[model samples]
Target: MTRQDISELYRGYIDCLNRQAWPELGRFVHQEAQYNGQRIGLSGYREMLENDFRAIPDLRFVIDLLIADPPHIAARLCFDCTPVGELFGLPVNGKRVSFTENVFYEIRDGRIAQVFSVIDKEAVRAQLGNDSP
Candidate 1:
């Protein structure tokens, strides 16, 4: 796929996430998609996403930057979420939190097969008052 094609796929994927369209995300993820150092298969990933959405309630992913090359895409993404329940051990319920993450995607055959990401987890910690916000 050309860079444009891959970029659109990335956009669609994020859009799906923003919409909480769990099934739509599955359509673009490979059987085995690596996430956060774990090889989470499609079903596992879906369940994880559902759990997170249940906690956050209102979650949106914004693409700050997107770059596509053969079989890989680099994205700087901003996630805005409202805490409706407990997450990461914090009961920051009904509050809003915004965080940014950088994720690298390895794609093949128009499907995302792997992802590596890093976020300012410390910032998240602070937001929940576990650290200085």
Candidate 2:
């Protein structure tokens, strides 16, 4: 896929995620996907997302930054929501917090094949009443 094509595809993926359209995930994610070097495949990926939604009912991925380079995509996903309990090991406990997640993805065969993600735990901690990193 070209740069524009990949970028559009990623936007579609984000839309799907925001909509929680699990059945349509396969259109953007490969059947054999890997996340953070672990081969979770598409089902695991969906489950992870579902679990995230369960933890944060108002979860929504806001794209603060997006960079697409053919098979690679680097995205800064921002979130502003309240977690029911611990989040990123922090005691959020339904406190509203805003954080960013830096993620990288490898697209293969026009679908996401691999993903690497890092969430801003410190930001969440700060917003949750603890400033210490």
- On TM-score, the leading prediction is 2
Q: What lDDT tens digits, residue by residue, belong to model 2 across residues 2-46?
A: 889999999999999999999999999999999999999999999
Question: Among all windows of ten consecutive residues in candidate 1, which has the lowest summed lDDT?
Answer: 124-133
CA-RMSD of model 2: 1.0
Candidate 1 C-alpha error for residue 76, in Å:
1.3
Model 1, position 118: C-alpha lDDT score: 88
lDDT (10s digit) by residue, model 1, range 1-133:
8899889899888888888887688678988877977999888888888887888777778899999996899999887788776656667678787778899989976799988888766667787778644
How far is 55's C-alpha from truth in model 2 (Å)?
0.2
Query: Ten-residue segment with the worst summed lDDT in candidate 2?
Result: 124-133
lDDT value for model 1: 0.82
After superposition, which runs of candidate 2 have C-alpha atoms over 4 Å from their true positions?
Answer: 131-133
Q: TM-score per candidate, in order?
A: 0.87, 0.96
Query: Measured by TM-score, how close is model 1 to the native structure?
Result: 0.87
TM-score quality measure for candidate 2: 0.96
